[model samples]
Target: MTNPAIEAFVQEANDILETLEDQLLELEGSSDPAQVDAVFRALHTIKGSGSMFGFTRLSQFTHHFETAFDLIREGKLAIDGKLIDLSLKARDTMRRFVDLGGDNAEADQLSEAAEVKNLVAALQSLTNVTSAPETTEEGASQAGAASEIAVFDIWFKPAADDLRNGLRPDLLLGELEDLGDVTHRLDLTAVPSLEKLEPLQCYAAWAVTLTGATTEEAIKDVFIFADDSELEITKHEPPVAASEPELTTKTVAADKGKSNKTTAPIRVDSGRLDEVMDRLGELVIAQARLNQVTTRLADPMLEAVTEDIERLLTGLRDTTLSIRMMPIETVFGKFRRVVRDLSAELNKDIKLVTKGGETEIDKNVIDKLSEPLVHMIRNAIDHGVETREGRIEANKPEHGTVILSANQEGGEVLISLEDDGRGLNTEAIRARAIERGLLDANATPTEQELHQFIFAPGFSTAKELTSISGRGVGMDAVKTTVDSLRGNFKVHSQPGQGTKVTLHLPVSLAIIDGMLVRLGSDVFVIPLSAVQECVELDTLETNRESGRSMLRIRETLVPFLDLVDVFNYPESKDTRRRVVIVRAGNAPLGLIVDDILGQNQTVIKALSVYHRDVEGFAGATILGDGTVALIIDTAIMIRRALQQAKAQEAPSKYVAAGGH
Candidate 1:
């Protein structure tokens, strides 16, 4: 294997290690036979492949660790807390050995060797317990019984260069003979004419049949050193009532057994896929350039071909990109470990139920979302799930429930975190708002109004300082992080049922479908998710609302925000107005614009630091016409509109009370 292959092996080995660790951790608190088998298989695979890749130190360490797990697998050792703890420690040590290359360095080797020996001794003692009556006497008897089972039949025809490369066909056959009793037959057919055959060339085919007490994997171990040379092995199921003569096949011998599925198809790495996508992107841009260059040719046939090329390239690009798309389940699986550890640490009984984990999203988006997800999970365990006694008083289940789910809707993906515990305390939240001076003492805030305070900077409701919560930060940072990825965040809570936080993120942050609109002298782009509809605004006369136009859509009055006032745009003579209905969470507002330009496929670029603080603008994008357009942060704008609407309604409250 080359360096890249080695790195790939390391990555796969690390994933298996993580799997083993998590299984052991769960087994520490409970006894599960399935978990034991899973842990053993993971360690065994690592040991086998580690040796194949020349990581001798890793192979030796994992081999010893696998024996301990094997004892548990065979019912000789019952797993306990002490065994699980030592297994986790040993797994970590194997990781270190893999990361730090060789065993020749004395200082590191001495330390690791001591830990390995101690863990091995502990494991051996666990297996040495006196025989329990539950164990059947026949189990050990079955281990010694020998039964010959027919394995695979192989057909081999080596190339002329096989002998020159020092690969002897007879040597492979001899290894098979050691595995079990074998019958071999040589065929001279296709050997070619003797006058044309070279002395250094090999041209012979052979068939062999073998029977053994071991598995087919034991047979493949013999020929691991050979590349895909002319060799084929087919496993034969033993006959029940009828008997027939089978063909001769050959098998090789090795330390470990060979697997029947050794020649499985290989998959490309994401880095290679990314490289392909990059080239495809360039192809798309070049095709766009070609369309531009050919427009002046005045040939309909050229235009037709260009259109065909465009369609082909678009299809190719989408196909290539879809290869890198994976289900969100790959990421959600890791959180099981996080929740288990946090539950134990906080002394909280928690169960995590996940749904819609198979929802597909861009791989890049998944990677960037991991850290924010970790934070959300930690917060759910620390603050969202109430303590055991607290739950009983509230007439809820003593064990709290936290749910993580992902679903794809339209062009965006929605990830939600929900818990069944005591909900956010709005009274305490409002008091904190006043104490922090975010609101005045005289200010009366609604329930929805109070919940928004949790997203304010340096705002949290926890009273006492603990390692988990009460650090004076929470939703605000989560909001900021999601916003950075061009995503939207919303929080919902009932008085006692707990809280639900939803994240709406684009499938790919690099590109999106946006609607172009003109605001004053500047052109802006709004994501499609925010746009409900576009309509002509009519003036409202019943309320005698001045300067503001309201549209009645679906039997509800939607207020309009004038872009001229918000953006401070220069004067324009076109009085004809258009309303772009936008939504954020449950709130919707109409954005009044001078013109609604059409749909655009936008590639987003970041705004400079000086312009990042500009409210209501998330990022900027360049159009095909070489014009720069700003993308609106519709969530912030909708929140602002809600507050503005509330303030506008305050006058009616006083009027109803006769203005005392």
Candidate 2:
């Protein structure tokens, strides 16, 4: 079994490393003191925690990286592009050590690897480069940082119960000694008789005399994270006269975490949270069942009790969901490195601008969101953005811009990756589609229809392939992931303007507010996020002769599909029918159903493998009466309409998503 401390350290270390990369990137532009301090604190915390948790190799590697920041803190060195590059590379090395579960032979081998040796040598050289002539006042301070001149006395004793909490006094002392010259003696006076002693308890203390160019606060920082420990430091003044008694400065350590009035976050494994969410979903279903029973009983007291349970369930559900809601910025932060590295590799002046990062979404959705976004970003950089000279010739800025923005709608989150570059060449795309036999030669499709072919399998407009993209798999993968999430993807581009790809996704996949509708005796669900409104099907406006149909509501025409025909269910015999207006690919899609049942909270369940490939349905859910109702996939319905049009070579003003 892994020690809880080690587990916590690993989680915290990964989080720090993620933030550290962004911080390093920020230094390239700002390099402000506050940012520098943040980077330093992150490294210090990781080094201290790694050592405490037996990640000795990781701690050792981070110490060299930390030393560079220490120079920056003291104004000895400066933050430059070269130093940031080294820091980033060294940061990767530290992450590798952490991932190795350090202190093992593999980590030891990595510690002596060629790459590790070179990185350390480079950092040491950077430190040496800061050492100017000792004649200059600034250089003198840097030169004597490690030289023995100033003197200090230090004492430390661990809290009796701290060893059980993964305290390592020896490692702490070793880290301090690295700062300067030291002579130390161990004190075992606290040890009791052999019969009375507790083996698990720590009964050791240390007293040390140090001579170095270090300050009292610097020495005190060695025990920074060892809260509630007996630590004292006294700095001895240099002798002014031969007979004068030496005066010293005495200071005691204070608790660090409590100095800030914020409580430390408790890290629970994601799996545990998922389990809790699963249980909560079941409770919601049971509550629905209870509500149904009370309505059937028509008892005042039972209905009142059911109301209380319903109110309580609502609060619990909201609280549970809020815990799972993480900011999209966590993922957004990773893309800075992506943009930076890509800029270097492509030799293009490109900028990434992000907005609305504070928008929140489900962790599961965010987890699957990164890969597709990366593919799109890569596509935008490689294929969407033009070269600097080409952009200049086009009367555009020399540098290209990719704007990644996210915002939450009523029940959906809209994430868009838009680029101000040479927009999609619709004519070229149309030509390729015709050549590939993907479109009817005589049929004229809209610009949006031509753009859809950009995401088709094995589709590429590049004359020659590069390592970045052009295999045509990038956009195809994006579409696949989006479809699986039951999300909508729409592309809007102007010939000279740019292309913006917007993904409309639900805020949560586990549970959603769904509109219940019926087709004959069978019931189905349409995600409320997709539904715009419902209106009466005023007329039987069928166009089978042209293999197309439309529904006119007020003054607008929408492509409409009958659920009965789509699902092969019995047609409704009612005198009136209704159409649910759903947003699809910049236009409204209408779904004709027998009748509308009221909306309800839907707990989504993945379909069994045997039924997973069934079209027109996203997932299955248990209705209030305990029967399974398949959720209608609005995105799929739109795509199905698109495909049906192509099969018939129908000419229309709009096209749906599956293939454009």
Q: Which candidate number maximizes TM-score?
A: 2
TM-score of decoy 2:
0.89
| Model 2 ranges with Cα > 4 A deviation | 133-161, 181-211, 225-262, 538-545, 650-660
Q: How well does candidate 1 score on lDDT at residue 353?
A: 84
Candidate 1, lDDT over the whole model: 0.71
How would you encode candidate 1's per-residue C-alpha lDDT over 1-660 as one tens digit per residue? 346546656777877876776677678777687887677767766665565555667777776677776666556677766776677678878778677643457424744676677876776666565663244566455433323475667777665565664455676786578668799899778777879888887777888888776445445545544544566677665663357555444443321225534855456777887777666655655675677667878689989999999899878867766777788887887787788778889989898888998898888888777777887888878877889998999899899999999998888899999998777888888778778767666666567667767667778888788877777555666766777666776778887898898988878765568899987667899998779998865543213143234566767877667777778777655677778888766667888788898886666677898988888887887665566889987876775665555456533220110000
- TM-score each candidate: 0.75, 0.89
* lDDT by candidate, in order shown: 0.71, 0.83
Taking all chains together, the TM-score of candidate 1 against the true structure is: 0.75
Q: What is the lDDT, from 0 to 100, of the residue 162 in candidate 1?
A: 56
